[model samples]
Target: MDKNIIVSWMEAGMIQVPNLLMQKYKQIGLDEKELTLLLQILSFIETGNEFPTPEQLAERMTISSGECSGVLRKLVQMQFLSIEEGVSEDGIRFEKYSMSPLWIRLADELKFEKKQSDLKLTLLEEHDLYSLFEQEFGRPLSPMECENLAMWLDEDGQDPVIIKAALREAVLAGKLSFRYIDRILFNWKKNGVKTLEQARMQGIQFRQKTKQPTQPTTGTSSKTIPFYNWLEP
Candidate 1:
């Protein structure tokens, strides 16, 4: 409502608090008072005051200067904050509060959380793939079979969908064995069949070249099997 007051506010500028810090302060073990104090220090630093005294910071916060001092010490001890000594052009030593450590810790926390989430997703995918294999075979996979599956995923970097397609090809060809599935995957990879559509097209082309028409099954439900013999030359 007041133009002069708005102008003054605009001229005073503002301090930037990281969105990550607001979202993850509690996760990083910072309480309300501690967070407020850190914000005060950030404000001072933004205004060219790199090293504000505890009394100056406390004046803008709800806590007393003594409490501010204690919190600052605690932050330093936790490696979330640090005081670094620097020399000015006049060769005078001065101490400044550095928030680099806090930023580093927050970055590390984010990385750790992402790594954990990826690990969980990978484990879930692995479980589902194993279940699919076991259901298709109608038996629990042996330890060696499980290891091979893991190798295909982790070592060979095989796409899970591609592996599923290979398995389906093996089943349709009436050759449901790991060795056969492995050969199918190998041939698909060698021929640059990365996607399910590409693999299907390749199978169709191979069948057409050999003049093998899919035989229709007579039952309540009819099924067409597109079988490709990967082991054949």
Candidate 2:
């Protein structure tokens, strides 16, 4: 390793914590502890001769030994590894772990996900999604309402498909009001408005037919002046 490069990286205040880890935690879907665990594992693999044992992983994560074993087993179950049960130097062991080629692929996938979230999150904040609500409604929303709006836009939030169906229903029903979207959402969910076609079909239809004046009402007598009367005068 270049000493100067190493020193420079160390000097980066916190760059040593791995950009990937930072990015992972920054995503709304991932929490700090999960990110920390993944970072520790990745760092271990990068530095150690092979995949670290559960005990070693536990120590690094500052978790209990049993929890470490369980977590490692879960990783194996998650297909991040393909390990077989075996005994370690401690006589009996759960399993010995090895890296699957999938880790790199997963890192790439996770990084892509992280970047996409960053874009969406920044847009939501910079554009002020609360403003979207207020602008659309032509009124100021309550703080709680704004928080609800944020939840909808969150990366791990509710399905947009469901949320949109609710809006559609509210618009379709004469009872339709942005204020009533929450209540109408239940109806939309029950009605299963999966697409625009379904929603349009569900909307109210109006028909207009022009009616001619009812034949001047038969009870009324019609008065007319003869053309010859004017000549006599």
Candidate 3:
């Protein structure tokens, strides 16, 4: 390896992944999934010699024990680990798991993109709407919220069209709050606003009327009612 080229890549990272390392990885005994995980394991080890536990791997991949096992077996077979090593999240090498020199060297060359790609696999494979909602809300979505959201997608009765219209209204208004959607749904239900066409028409009417300023009329008909603001209450 040319020292100048090596220096250039190393400058890009605390440690750099080399094309030669990738070429060497190609000769390893592993399938695609194992290959990818191998690269990740190598990256961490290369960067810091950090070995993640199978449980952590499962969470990261959103995979089952059996699936993680299959991948782990390949790692062990390919000499990524000879023994199952256990370590807490903190950096400690309390146990020994037999791993290959190539794996170690490859790990040193690991990059963030590989780790992030593994995480993206979990996101794409899992039904994370529940967790996503929890993350946004700072609390888990309630069973009622789940049911309500589900109802929006149900194919069986209750016009899916109406639900779509409501979704569009929220999107167009740049107001995606469940509270606002709930209010729209509530008023729609009360007023028998069942179809998308009906809701859209109502939405248009609302836009038109809100854009129109209130006229100052005389007589006792004009009354400034306090406490009309929901946020104030």
Candidate 4:
């Protein structure tokens, strides 16, 4: 409706509240009242009032000036807010509120959460890789085998998908040994075969180059067995 109200609202402007602050306020130990107070302080700062009095802040809040003062003290004590003193251009001293500490704390919290999420995903991938290996090998891995698998993951930094592709290559060649799989993985790594599709294409090219017309040995069929020899250059 009203044109004058709309103009007044437009002139009043808006305050910016970060999504992260809204989502993580409780986790960071801020209650609803404290969060509202922080937003009010931010709104005042945006409107050219960096240091609003408790009574002024209370005018737009449900809390009284006394409660507002107590919350402001708590915020300062918790390092979420700071008041810095400065001399004006007229040589008069003044105090202004700073929200830098709150922002820094929120940034640290986000970083810590991301690190935890990454760690969980890595652990899950490692577990799935181990299970796949045991299923293919038809037995639980020995301590030495487990260590080698971990080395391939943690030290060599091999992708779990590429490792699985290597295992499949060994199985297809009818040479289902860990040594053969390791050799395939090593060759694939040396040739920069980092994905399952790349490994398959490389295998096809190697077999084509090495294809030969074979004379079957005695008691063997004439059909040639197709296998890429990873051990050979």
Q: Write the per-residue lDDT of candidate 3 for residues 42-78, one digit (tens) a residue.
A: 5556655465666656665656757887788766665
lDDT of 4 by residue, 16-58 (tens): 8999999999888899999999999999999999999999999
Q: What is candidate 2's lDDT per residue for 31-78, written digit by digit as tens?
A: 455455555666665564245766777777778878877765665566
C-alpha positional error of residue 115 in candidate 1 after TM-score superposition, expressed in Å: 1.2
- Candidate 4 TM-score to native: 0.77
Better of 1 and 3 by TM-score: 1
Off by over 4 Å in 4: 64-67, 82-95, 212-226
The C-alpha lDDT values of all candidates are 0.88, 0.54, 0.59, 0.89
Model 2 reaches what TM-score against the true structure?
A: 0.33
- TM-scores, one per candidate: 0.77, 0.33, 0.30, 0.77
Residue 165 Cα positional deviation in candidate 3, in Å, after optimal superposition? 0.8
**Rank ordering of all candidates by lDDT, starting from the highest:** 4, 1, 3, 2
TM-score of model 3 vs. true structure? 0.30
Selected candidate, larger lDDT, 1 vs 2: 1
Model 4, residue 2: what's the lDDT? Answer: 95
